[model samples]
Target: MARESDEVRSGTLPQATGGRRIAWAAVPEAVTAGIERLLGARVVGAVSQPGGFSEGLAARVRLASGGGAFVKAASTLTAPAVAAFHRREIAISRRLPRTVPAPRLLDAYDDGDWVALIFEEIPGRLPAQPWRRDELERVLTAVTDMVRALTPSPVDGALLGGPRLGGWAALANSAGIESGVVKKLEALSPWAARHLDELAALEESAAPALAGQTLLHGDLYPFNILLTAQDVFVVDWPHAWVGAGHCDVVTLLASVSLSGMDPQPIAESHPLTHDLDPAQIDAVLATHSGFLLRIAASAGAEADRHLVDMMVALGLASLRWLRDRL
Candidate 1:
């Protein structure tokens, strides 16, 4: 018989942003209760992790069995979008293999207002250290292998899954830049305005090249990977989509490089970066910095402001590197 506990409760779902304090309403209380009952365990502890771009409640739930799980329920302010996003994630995850360095999708529940997903917690730590040569080589090789294994999937822009070839336009549109960032970027140089104009041109030019490609890890970064004892595992699939393979490569490299560390040696040694134009490489990083800043600015929280500033600085640094490239 289906457990009565399986039915999700309405009031228990948290408001958007979870209302500042750690609240129980964000996750569907029924789902939590059901998970514990179904797993033959208890939720010994739980903590809400913040900085989520989407409307979702992410919590680390520790079970009585000494195992833990990450549970989340997403509800975009718009109902249709919430359903679509969840569906996309589920569909794409079904295609991925367990051997690949990614989190396994455990369970999914679509309860109207919210869509909940649970995944077995992968143990390990995020790489806090700088982009060392060995780490860079390892990450590049892993991504190369991951990309090679993917088969061309059908196009579904809503789900963040599609061919890898459509990257540039998607990135240009979604990288999150706005007037505030544009103004700030302009401040970087008298030529900065001209440069942004050039970027606009680049976006237009790159659109044709970006269509009908392969899948990509839309948000690849060291922080997204869990460095375990055996190997590294990538997490955070909310941004996964189909795009040019090089888009993921650029995102990965720019993410590591903008950590305020020297990436020249690592870039030179790694085959992925070895053949690329140094200036072009720098421009990609700069463009991504703007992308990150736009996302951060949209958060509107004080904590988010501080984080955005740091990212803006990184973007500015990338701009400087690119200026030298030009």
Candidate 2:
């Protein structure tokens, strides 16, 4: 029998449970009223969507005019980080090429403390867990298409760099093995503790390997992807960044590995990574693993336990995958 954490490691548990969400009705009346004015229709009904780690509003709202739209709103007073993410998403969504599969941003509202965005609601469901091969293929194809469309990113100005790729190096240099992070790593995996130096070196060398002109959906987990009968749509732009195209592919494959499938073959054969140096791929895996570990370690006391568990599982999966490659 497999352990419960094993189910998490394979991507099943988190799919069965989702993050807590703020109900549409729970949003401030003034905020909803403002949203209605922008939508050009009165909101008649609303159903909150789930699956991400934020406690912000994410819902499909019905209009008196019989149309519907997706809404995401957060209060800077309560969730400053989430509000900041919404602000970034608003900026990036405006600049996305028309060809990208993301839903178009219809309207936005920001009044210093509250942020809201309305998007053309996509008609689709999340990709199935245990990942049916056909659906995964469709999503992968869509990801490749998105990468191509986003190359030489259309957005301008200072996009966030992939600094998380340096997590291991930072851990290694911080206060030696007695550091809180080292203690956390040892608690997670003795193997990680034993190989700390090597992992740090691999992650430190990842900077050059990660450089490129492509914009990445930095968080490409299953929750951020939606599948329709004929196409796949990627959503959630809060973490978008410009980097090597393979970085997104690598992140997706790491999530895929949680389905008890071998992601190495796909990683090796995928067009984005197929011709790249094998060592560069290793560096990416190390960087990603370190990144996950760091996030899990630093998760706040108020953090959702389920999401923290998912992060730990995915981090372990990335480490196992990296070990196999080594």
Candidate 3:
């Protein structure tokens, strides 16, 4: 189902990166035994999946029963933040309607410190980098479908707004711009320094523009998406929120730009955004761009190198797209 362009075939694009991962064999015996008890089968084989910035366990496992499942596990002792995310995902996954395209959450286990989620094994691969036109179309169609299905926000207590959705105004304030973070951002792109105030003003309208009832995936990086012959599946829901449906599409198109594709045309014609006001789109883009730049700017020396790199790349891409729109 993958369609790679000549550049991707030649490996010219930066390879995807993630956090250090622990082998499934190294997982605590108690946790593994608990997972087996939940599955009603002994795990016979496990292959780790290394495509996200979580220092936890993500794997495809074969059971002695001859079936397979995707397993994600983390512990407070090792990856407390990731364990918290797992807890939230478990809550959100249980409420997801069957019509949604995410992998079905088969079961979950928690032992006060360790958390694990078991999902139905999906036979799919990450979408090609520097996306092929046809494949991008399919993925866009899938986003539209998912948006339609998630309208009115089925999950209760989901966030209406968060750091990812807003903050440009605060970030543009005098103290903020003078801080090391904004300085770091300005170093990455001089354009950001020149138009900080204008971008902040544009973002003032973002809150009203983004208010909606659709549940957004919030993070739709290519690595979080999987493609099979028949379907596109969005994984990783820790950042999911209830907001404008077009939000996810905007975030995704920004990533497309990061992968070296011009996302303007795709954004112009994509169903989720085609009819929206250009200014509204600009507001959302500003909000997102500010968010990414802030993260990139504030990333600590001990932060995951890959995660920081992606944040900076995608931040620049979103800012570039916003600049073009203006």
The CA lDDT of each predicted structure is: 0.54, 0.80, 0.80
The residue-by-residue lDDT of candidate 3 on 89-170, one tens digit each, is: 8988888898999999999999998899999999999888778888888999999999999998898844322537555566
Q: What overall lDDT, based on C-alpha atoms, would model 3 receive against the true structure?
A: 0.80
RMSD to the true structure for each prediction, in A, is 12.0, 3.7, 5.5
- Which candidate would rank higher by lDDT, 1 or 3? 3
What TM-score would candidate 1 get against the native?
0.71
Off by over 4 Å in 2: 1-18, 157-163
Across 151-177, the per-residue lDDT of candidate 2 in tens digits comes to 888876374534355467767775745
Which TM-score value belongs to model 2? 0.93
Candidate 3 regions exceeding 4 Å error are 1-14, 158-163
Clash count list over all predictions: 15, 1, 0
